[model samples]
Target chain A: MIENVTLDISGERFQVFYRLRCEAQDVEAFARHICVEQTIEFPAELIGDDDIRRHVMGQVVSLAPLDDHSWRVVISYAVEITGFSLTQTMNVIFGNVSLMPGVRVDRLEFPDSFLSRFKGPRFGLQGLRDLVGEKHQQLYCSALKPMGLSADQLAQQAYQLALGEFHFIKDDHGLADQPFAPFRERVSRCVEQVAKANQQTGGSSRYVVSLNSPAEQIVEDAIWAKEQGVGGLLVPPGIVGFDMMRRLADDDRIGLPILCHPSHLGSYVASPDNGLSFYALFGQLARLAGADVSIYPNFGGRFSFTRDQCLEIVKGCTDPMAILKPIVASPGGGMNFSNVQDMVDAYGKDIMFLIGGALHKGDATVPENCRAFKAQVAALLRR
Target chain B: MIENVTLDISGERFQVFYRLRCEAQDVEAFARHICVEQTIEFPAELIGDDDIRRHVMGQVVSLAPLDDHSWRVVISYAVEITGFSLTQTMNVIFGNVSLMPGVRVDRLEFPDSFLSRFKGPRFGLQGLRDLVGEKHQQLYCSALKPMGLSADQLAQQAYQLALGEFHFIKDDHGLADQPFAPFRERVSRCVEQVAKANQQTGGSSRYVVSLNSPAEQIVEDAIWAKEQGVGGLLVPPGIVGFDMMRRLADDDRIGLPILCHPSHLGSYVASPDNGLSFYALFGQLARLAGADVSIYPNFGGRFSFTRDQCLEIVKGCTDPMAILKPIVASPGGGMNFSNVQDMVDAYGKDIMFLIGGALHKGDATVPENCRAFKAQVAALLRR
Candidate 1:
């Protein structure tokens, strides 16, 4: 019989403990469910006569309350996994069987052995700040746009944004393998243009190109972007699996910071009191999954996230708990220069302010427009 | 200039049409947003100024309301594709920047020329019914366990259920690659044991295994499972990418009915007047993606979905649509033998009644238990 199993749920580096109680005789089976089952609710097909025969076999034994709102559950089950490898253990914890409802993960104890293997964040907050040469300053960020532009046109926009001394300039998530501006050509042109602007301005304006290829194409794209001398890669982990991001983060050859984009992930945490909380999903999950910068929608934008939710997301990104790495919270969507002061006030100096169309809403020359937006943001942040 | 783009929204499928007015200089960019971006409502970094500019360019020129509460919006845009192959057309529509936010897919016009290349579903409604030989009758479905059952143990239970002649025996969503009954071992053993029972009883009870492997492992798992003679594969398209299911459905070599599981998809349609409705997500989208059967939590379950939502899902599944396919609505969670008659009454004769733990809540052996469950369900249908 297995008495207990341990889990590490990362929330801003703080290791929260969860204990699962297993009433079943098979401890390994119980442990597997604890790791992967999203919730404790069971579907009708899973329970058989024998399952009901030992209905009380899998039940919570004890759950210790953590300092945070989270609790650690401990379960006891008669299952065994003496020779299971880490990968096997991970599969057991998160395998297909754990998708049953009402299967609460009771005991979540993080042993130093398990915690040691997980490299939380390779380049966290300070590392990113150092890379960009910004000390305790709010970073200005913008995105290159609409899919129809040629590589040169997109690069020109990157140059304009870089000339404003913007801290970060990422490709629109839509700018992947399109023939209009193929990824390689776009990355090369944008990186070169940004480099030129950075040389003239003596500022560190990193160009992050979109790496929106599928799994097979992901690493290839990352390696290609790195060869193109791009500062970072913008990845939509939601569309691509999180494991791909983890793999990219682990690769030293792909040494660029990853800007995590939230697309198609609204379904994961859109419901109230169900699925994961926004802070947990965009902030904690993104950071633990190795995102250096996590971008979510700003409140009063076209999206429905509230101001409180946005603030909580920012807190989840920066709050120091365990050895969790801090990530930059980049908020955009319907954001404008007029609200720079408000955004700065709300998110503090260590944030990334992302302004989109409002930067080029009117017919203004790209460089001058970017400079005006930059000046407004700088003046607001100085307050 | 592109005159109009049409979308097939599924209910009253042949009658359903969405026309968009595309005045945008970048018609493909506008179409991409309308199809994918606006639907998911991604954050600003993912969807940038260019996307919004193009979207603003395309207006709803004319909306022709169709039956079944569906409407078609017409949009005229610059640059229509001519003399392009299907792949080229897809590339033009979504290639470079498919993952961006707020990029609504203004149009998804599937011409038979392109649709002919796709296999759609190999074992759609009639094929699956033919395999089971249970004509004009609602099917009885149940899950294997919550979690923690070993391969031998799961096989024994599966054998007993097979003896009782369950139309469908599926893995609980939680039963992924867990250690207790590793995926390959569990699946192999369960399929063999069930096959043996089928041989004995001259019954056609089928086993549907959950193929929740990561993106890279998905195709391999599907192929492997099919080779192993598993009757069907359960796919939670939401957790995995939606395209994976489409690929599986298109695979003629693996002619298995794909059971769509709504595990982490609550966030997409959980809210009213916000995201897609339940019918749209579970019904139209799932069907369009090639789900022969769609599973959702029944009204009285622990989950918050209402009777109306369940009914809508069924309507979406069975209503006259393009290449009308029968999608068995398997409602579980807090459902049991006691409510078989009521369930049959509500959902009618074309439903798949799924009863989980309650079937095993008594001291009856697996065969006897399943027998009693089948008897009750049969009696209800007769009544």
Candidate 2:
């Protein structure tokens, strides 16, 4: 059936190059286990058969020993196998083998044939900048926090933030459709307040509400957000499937800039040699999955990401690849006003600094705190 | 705004008790970090506010030091916060903290009020038994594999296995609507073949096709599968969202026995001191999402699952809980016709033994191998 199975390394098939840490194990046996577990879970004899080996089994392109105990193996699969869907592509890459210990997905290589399947980001870096009308300086984004606040209270906070120097105001990932503030009511009020603030300040400040709900409702709410003319939409691809983000990006009816939040997704990258690289998980994959702005925790912040990890995330967002455009790397979670200069130096221009609690701190008002954070970043641009 | 926030530990709120391995660290500070990361990503001073603390903050119910390093911490969240949705529930439990190291989620305790939102397993153990018409014996399931085979060839294999003894015939998790054999054609042919084989052998073999596809296509294909009289439907909740399983389970119109496959979800359970427990991920969560049968890798097999982990999965599947019915605990991956007795001894009855490669091995034909597998399990019952 696989009459024209290509063995050429530079072929059209999108490849997932996995960097597995095979500690003192039989490299060949481990490779076979990965190949069989991922693709054809059949007998050895059947897999040994040339036809099955060529067509179905994953092609082991290269295997190099990293140390006495680890091996850096590169295995490539035909794009036809994955059907170019993000969900199936992930299954082919790490579905069954995820059960195995010490195997990490360090690199992912996708040909244009595969990349063409996804819309990537609708309003990518340039488009988002164009929308905000801030072409020169780095962006400042913040989330409405202390989630017990009612819809009106949250909206008032959003208004205050918008009145300040914040370009993007978002609902905290925890602020789902609860009794205190339902989805429709919360989204409507917040968007309206930001709009009012935008009109008063004569600045483009967008309020992106979280659209993470049930599947059908996800689409419905996204459409409703578009209808309401909300500046952008926030979706947690970690909680919802990554493919759902692609679907949202591809949907012509719901044309809105998407902000992808990393909630319930840290397990994939927390381990050193088990799950995924910071660049791959938060950067490349998030961009490919149609995240206009990818929000993760800052390095000096309360979260456990290292400075190098943060830099890699930035590179992954802006790295030149195929036709895919670069996305905004928005880092937050325990970020404060004091660290803005250091963060600006670390991430440079084209970054979105997401400071939450710090913007609400100090003797000054929330807007004043926001102004100070913005001024600090703008001063760095002048330097 | 938070009118009636409860401080009582014995309230209707759901609690997730995590056994974090914080080595020689400040236990209270670490606990507050988790609480803040999971809920309000704000300042400690803001969190210390009584109104915000009582209403929004995740309460540290108990904290006890373990050994020189690790600590056992119990945290509780208001059920109203999650809105009783599975997506929101997971977010509240581990969303941001999953990014942090050494924070393993050991226990999850949900009240009946929270659990009542989900319809756990429609058919369950007894319903599956009634469907197969085998009341007392253990179920034998097989995957039609070596994925490159055409639809006709795979269907022929399914027919052979059905004629011999397989109670449940499923597509391997890898087999999506690939170019070799598209989903609709393969599913239609396999169902017809199994139905024909069932008629010939006077057996009640059920062909459960994999419905792992795009979101919209998933619902459409489920409807199509029902129209084609498919016996059961298997969904990979890992690839799609867990809420998709809930959606499929809640759909009364389709009403096919749903089998939840644990593909692309291993990262959550691979780490010892992080992510989720085996019982919670595979057992409790799967059942709550409406998995009539939950499939996971068996211990003493090709996979890395330990014996204790496998047992916990069984306990999770069959544990006593509200009105939710107990589902079948299917331990699979690299199982064989030889290990039937050992598995029976370990899991006893009410288990589904899924053997793939081994069934296709030995001098016996595929059907003969299936027959031998069934006989081996049946002989255990004779004891």
Candidate 3:
């Protein structure tokens, strides 16, 4: 599958853009330190092998001062060292250096060799749109909430939401295999109920179950969810490994679109000067890992993502990568019906507006609330 | 079997100690917000069901002002909500609330019902000490380095390190299935060579391979590594899910002491007011997820762990948790031979000195350097 791998000393390399928030004098040194620390982690003088020194060692290609207090540096690592796996690529990019402070990964650029390695997002924006067979420009999604609800109660909730004709109805990230409503029981009941509602309304509503478990069990659960005629899967890539999600995305047997949730991953994007950018973590990496849809906290939400950061997240998701499909960005932390127009106005049509709690704040019943949400979204798209 | 689970209005609950870094006036309100956001995530007025509100909702047990600008809050959730799973436990504790800016998880306390769910560590401190069969107070571990080395070259290095009689020699976390040294070839060769060296020296030197891959492959690789006569496993719980490592530690067939490396988990501990404390993230959570030894950056290391923070991490690893055995703390990240005495004096006997690059920096050959390291440790411990 890897057609053209540059094996020479100047072999094609994947580039990582890092924003070093340090003293002006220490910028180059900081960039050089990342180069050394990322690869060999040993004194360059000690590395006798020239091949490893030149190829395996991370190469710093560009360094520019961002301002008085910060510098932007671009570092490159050999394509061969990544071994064409998401885990290794992440290791080469972040790995031990993630422990360091005042460094933020801005973005990443991969060569053809590295890009060809992953089958990112099996059902991205177009595929998902095709699946839905909907004419609306903006798709809407709602989450089933209150974790202690029994299978029947949650399924009934799902039926009400699906009847609203939202493109996707997903389980809350917290809804795992709990004793109150076990995974199999909850997933099957929700799938069946959603399907029955869809059949009645002649709408193609898909129910997504959260697959947050150990690796082996997640795969098993994914297969089971697919067998139950479930349309999609919600996986927190931070909880389960990204590559694990990639495996699920690439697996044809259970080829459901994966929706990535920001669970334990907030820390990575929270620190502006310490960790990775929201664009890189949520958008690029999620797509590379085969997530058809990625979710993050929207602006004016309970969470602390600014409008600019949220917009950047949308850019990362729908931006053109080499051959990878642009994934749909679903922004929902404290989303409500009142802000629905504002969200769509900012993110435009390709996005999925995930309105969770606001659906409950409606004056009408739950199913009636769904119909009202449909009218608002349809009206917004027409505008 | 769950012995006694209180199932009333005031039932047994697992406690999450959080530090809210906000204004004094917003202390209780902030704590209350976490209680609401962590569970249900919906407004109380919207939830008509009394049972769901009373039983499943997160309870704010204690709230106190820590300083003029911060507050200490202890929130508890029903044991039934956790569903006796690490994935869900993490979700309930952090989950959606992880996106909050001013909150930090200070510590955690589990009830009997929650504690009984996990079989902590199969091989804790004593179990690992038995495996080594050495009389040394502080165990020594070294990492095989400089990526892009062939499997034969790495195996030779492993053999040399084993001949040095270090307690354990581990593959660097970056060493995945690269073309230079495929995982199987590197693991099998290193295991064989280390065993041969141990046979010659009459030492019980263990070769720990880094299993940083997808879930299914990691388990399969672990079983195969065990069959190849590997003595231990090194897992990055951050890259691979924490529960995945727990599954390996609990698996009886491939029973080996698990060493946890902090790879992509730095941001969680880096920010003072945004994410989790070093103690809670590295110490308590790692042990709860079944790590026999947890590795983090030392105080004076290349990384930015303060001396106090490092000590807290140690306490977290070895402190008493219900029925869970105390795991050894392996403090690494730019550790050298010069700091061995200081490290031991600070950490006492129940620690492992993971000296990697320093082993190569010695005047003598690596094998001679190993013996010198042994003499230094033995002499220091006798004092």
For model 2, report DockQ. Answer: 0.59
Model 3 has an lDDT value of: 0.84
lDDT tens digits by residue: candidate 3, B1-383:
00112223447788999998888777878888888888777676666546667778888899888788878899998877776788878888888777889888999999755687789988888888889985548788998887777888888889999999988999988888888888999998999999899999999999999888665488898998999899899998888878888888989988999999998888887688878888898899999989999999898988888888989989899888888899888888878777877787888888888888777874688899888987887788788
lDDT of 2 by residue, B1-383 (tens): 22333232224666777868775557788987787778766665654545457756788889987767788899988787786687888889888888788887876888876787778889999999999998888888888887777788889989988997689999988888887788989988999999999999999999988877876578888888888978888888887888888788878877889889988788898787788889888888888888999999998888889889999999889897677899999999979766777798898888988888787776788889888888887788789
Worst lDDT run of 10 residues, candidate 1 chain B, spans: B7-16
Q: What's the count of clashing pairs in each model shown?
A: 98, 1, 1
Candidate with top DockQ is: 2
TM-score of each: 0.74, 0.96, 0.96
Docking level for model 2: medium
Query: By summed lDDT, which 10 consecutive residues of candidate 2 chain A come out lowest?
Result: A1-10
Higher lDDT: candidate 2 or 3?
Answer: 3
Model 3: per-residue lDDT, tens digit, A1-383? 00112224448888999988888877878888898888877766677646777788888899898888878899999887777778878887888778889888889899765788788999889899999986548777889877777778789889989888888999987888877788999998999999999998899989999889765487888998899999899999887778888988989989998999888888887787878899999999989999999999999988889899988888899888888999999998888778877887898788888888777764677778878876777788787
Model 3: DockQ vs. true structure: 0.52
Model 2 residue runs over 4 Å out of place are A1-11, A47-50, B1-11, B47-51
Best by TM-score: 3
